[model samples]
Target: MKSKGFGKKALDLLFPPRCQGCGKLIDRDDGLCGACLAKYGDEQRESCPVCGRTARECSCGAAALGSSFIGNRRYCAMTFYNEYNADSERITEKLIFRLKRKNSSSLTDFFAREAAAEIMRLMQLSEERPEEWIITWPPRTPRAVLEYGYDQSEAVARRISYYTGIPWKKMLVRTGGREQKGLGAEEREANVSTLALLRRKEADRKRFILFDDVITTGATVREAADLLYGAGAEAVFPVCIAKTLLKEKTDDEGVFV
Candidate 1:
């Protein structure tokens, strides 16, 4: 059998490491090149710390707000993309789409590290830390998984677990449902309402931080939080890599305009 070191060298030779953001060849697999890394340095400044919306337009409603979820739950996100601005939003969307659809390993690692940092910040800001905090995710439907050949949320969750030293579990299972994409706001909520169930005996009064790739309408994560809360979780925190913000437009007789 080939030695482990030799095998690693051979693999590296066959497929060189590339930067996650720009796909440029890099020395390591874990980070973006300096230029790509610089792009995300101001992400927090571009997003609302409270609502995870872009600074220019962030009127988050009660349901859409992360703190309004059940069971003393709160939501937080890493970056916000304003949909009306195609130039900026496309940059965010490209990263997310590559991660979800292409299963980009470097992007996954990058997001996982970012998420771990956010969790750490939350822990520091919390009034009292929980006895134990577990990592979990709202699973994708089996059909979607089969079609995509991977689960994006699960991938990120495992990486977050690795980075934070918190245990990760597949606590929720999707009970087959239509895809949430292209659905209206209410339809999106209804589509995902009964889609996920807590795995048997997995939620035993533990605190959970549910991870996802993005938060558009907040319906999917809300449903997942409801399941965790129902399964006796003491608290549920929803975390995402990106938050989508709706653009504001005035009507013909808009007084504010």
Candidate 2:
């Protein structure tokens, strides 16, 4: 006789759920597929909230770069993409690998959900009063967006907005700046922050969290934040999916508050 267990029934109903990470069929309902999930299990690790590195390194790492415009501000993220440099600067670096090449729809959702959960945690821990939190990512020039087909940062942010219920808008634009990822470590540090502005409307709200897929040099996001601050935004906090955990010297401190 067959077992009448509900677990067996649920499994049959889903009939081999697909994995979010590698796109393989799995026997569970977890966030990721088995193989792909395990592959990145080690890839994704805890990051420092203060500096978006490791918890232990947060003290020194964040303090060293705490001189930039958004330096002293508080933002929460699930992981840090900037840390990918120590390992590799390849095109498929960090979140780019899963979201782009793998074509994993669930993968981006996984990131958004994780980030939303972290944000919730931070709000509870710090007792941040929720007036209104807008979620926006670094914008791309029309030419760049046409070239890439889609901006992975904004795509991930869109999914995040759906999951977290936080309003996201096109409040920041990108001026013609050097690609932060392609630059060498030193060049990445030397590039100045230049955030383009978005015209405001009647329904527009302030107090926002800038979202990005990854934060390597932090220059790109910093530039975006500068633009928002200049446009009468009450506050701008950045949230990247992943951050660089590697050791490096920073002249600009990544932020200035």
Clashes of each: 0, 17
Model 1 / residue 160 / CA error / Å: 0.4
Best by lDDT: 1
- Residue 138 displacement in candidate 1 (angstroms): 0.7
Per-residue lDDT over 133-219 for candidate 2, one digit per residue giving the tens place of the 0 to 100 score: 778877755445655567677777888788777777877665554656668888867664445676654113467778877666667
Give the Cα error of residue 256 in candidate 1, in Å: 21
Task: Quote the positional error of residue 229 for candidate 2 in Å.
Answer: 1.0
CA lDDT of every candidate:
0.69, 0.58
Q: Cα miss at 158, model 1 (Å)?
A: 0.8
- TM-score for every candidate vs. truth? 0.76, 0.66
Candidate 1: TM-score?
0.76
lDDT of 1 by residue, 1-257 (tens): 37766675577688888876677898877767877676766654575544455532333433444443323335666667544332343445557777777787778888899888777766766543533788888887775786899999999999999988888988888774576667799876676424566574678677888898877767777778877777777777778887765444333221111
Among the numbered candidates, top TM-score falls to: 1
